[model samples]
Target: MRSTLPTFNEVWQRQCRSSILSDEKQFFSKNTFLVACSGGMDSMLLLCLLHCLFPQRVRAMYVNHQLQPDNEVWATFVQNFCEWHNIPYLIKKVQVAKGNLEAQARHARFNAFQQTICSEEILVLAHHQQDQAETFLLRLFSGAGVNGLKAMQKIAVKENIKIWRPLLDVPREKIEQWIKQDSIPYVTDQTNFDEHYDRAWARHTLWNVIKPRFPKMQTAITRTALLMQDADEILYEVLQQDFKCCGNENSLDIQALNDLTPARRRQLLSWWLKTEYRPSLDTVDRLQNEVMYARTDAQAQFFVKPFWYVRYQGKIYRLTEQQKKPKQYEIEIFDCQNIVLNQKYGLNKDLLKESLMLYPRIGGERVHLHGRVGTWPLKKAIQEAQIFPWQRDQIQILKKEDVILGIITPQGFWLAQSDYCVPNGWLPKLDGVSV
Candidate 1:
């Protein structure tokens, strides 16, 4: 005789006792759970389960993307359900950004969720086994590497917010069965049947046709994702070891990067940039061809959105846009200590009585070195001083009426003219350097 299957509550309790959930028992006990409910079958089941298990610790949040005409209807349904169960509830409305409708809607939804939940709350999602399978197929079709193929996890962190998906390993059929058996109320989203979205197309068009022939495909895909997760962890460990030998958070050593194998080099570059920014594979390839392989003396730069990655002096540095400084300003000598010049450079103390004018460098401008006989072109002087090309425009030229006092380099050092120098005198020091 076939044995009777476990009830939904029994299955949930059994899963909770599993090693993964058991390991996080203390964390789950300490933090309140904010369930992301969309008034859908899966989410409603998650909300119900959590509420039934830990009623006081569970709260429901519904994020309305406002993409559909019935968005408010869904929100009201989730709110009513929460009120009926006496659970704390929050509803956030978000405007989806312009772009791929599905991606933008997802981004907006998550943004709302992230903005609503605090550090003391763990954001719980309702992604199940089939959802993982669908994500795996989507990433696979998009040519994602091991990192992407790993898909979602039971526990993860995003932007310092902890996320938990307790039902991640549970199958969708089981969830539907439990919901129907318990007579839970939920609203159906008609958009799920629309094939215009990639996930919808994969589910309705691709998976439906394949499921009959390969009934166990979802389980197989989920297993593959688990393996990929392990592979991704190993790769991260290797990258950490490689990072120590090469560089730190802000920059990478060009020579060390070049010595790595082509594949490893690409991995390191992708890993390094991903710490603060997301870079496309094409961007990584372009950086390898244009910046890393450029001639040693050549100053090569690759733009990645708002910032630029530049190669100079055997190091690749990420350059953020600096704040715009005044084009020209006049200051008294007594205030020189508050400006951008190194005080060690000698300047006549008597001249402190006169005002000095500071101007940003323009092309063809020239300055005189203190010990040198003649004037030097400002551009040539900056180049000889080894200032970064990106920082050249930020150099300040100091003047006293018609006489050129000196110029302040980006590094806060002063190049005083011979006429302005005294055996021992006062100079100013700038506080910081632009990276």
Candidate 2:
């Protein structure tokens, strides 16, 4: 009687050499992991593989983006799959905002998964070599630089999450072959054939044409991406030494930047734009002309939209203009998990300081500044605090009893989440330092 979990585990061990896998690393212990399963063939196989290899260390996680007509059906299918095998499964429903269809859905999905990941858990994605090649071609067509052309990396991080794409080395054809050989039941997403989406079009049409012409293109991609990643590592090392910072909040020291060759400077700038901000190429081009080309000025601001990045005083600052605009709020509360939403300049730790409180953006709320005169309404005070309008209500002012902390601004900062209480003589760093 061969158990289903064991069969899945074998596939995982054979296909993906996750060191957190038992036999793969002889000396060290295997680290635990969570697999992101979409109920699609690729991820279903992924779930089975993980269960087969390291059942105790692996958990299947399904995120319902609520986009597909079969969303609930798919979730139910996954639930039944997990239940039959006695595997632990988590189903997370994310309210995907309608616009930027792909991007918004992806962000929401990742955010929910990120919320689930802890220091002990790593996330595995079933992105195969076809995905790798498709990503590369897509980046090339989009006129992406070295990083984009390099495409998907084997492993990456977001916040506290570790994302691993072990199947990057394996072709999608191989996965399909295995599924068939194993007699695995899988769902086919009909939308994959639609040409409206660029990636879908690329996968269905362009891949056949380009793959044959190049023949050994996958090897070239692998080698070139490796070289690029290596070069990028060195560039990052320099950035770490010279810029001394990371994240979307890029504060580049122009004086230091000027020391590098024009090409190096451009590369660094491009890196910041693509990797850190994920801005449009038009935005990047505009930035090069507006901010990077001329002498760095203190007040000359390049209003990088969505992600508020400004070049000022020979430094790059990633803060939303929402900080400068006014905000309105009303109080409410809900029992919630601990989470940190980033705000302008700094990150606010969303600990359960006292209790959970929710508040909608409304007209009346007071912000009490320490060194300033008296308190003012949250709206008026944000004008003083320079909080942006779009970012209002992002900050949940937790109220237990009669106390009100500052609200959670959209940028992830707790902007006075507990009243604009800047401790005495504590000078903060970055652009908005209230020393």
Model 1 Cα shift for residue 124 (angstroms)? 0.3
Task: Report the Cα lDDT for residue 97, model 1.
Answer: 89
TM-score of 2: 0.66
Evaluated against the true structure, the overall lDDT of model 1 is: 0.78
lDDT of 1 by residue, 1-435 (tens): 322222456555665436334634756778888999999999998888777666678899999888888999999998877776688999999999898888888889888887888778999999999899999999988878888899998889988889988888888888887888777878999989888888889888998799999999999999999999999999889888888888887678988987888878888888877744446789799987788888877768787766678887888887665622222323434345454333555677766677777666778987677767787787787777787776676677667787777676766655567677765566655445321
| After superposition, candidate 1 runs with Cα above 4 Å error | 1-26, 275-280, 296-299, 321-355, 359-385, 413-435
The lDDT values for all models are 0.78, 0.64
Q: For candidate 2, give the lDDT.
A: 0.64
**Poorest stretch of ten by lDDT in candidate 1:** 323-332
Q: List residue ranges in candidate 2 displaced over 4 A.
A: 1-30, 244-255, 271-276, 280-285, 288-299, 306-435
Rate residue 385 of model 2 by lDDT. 59
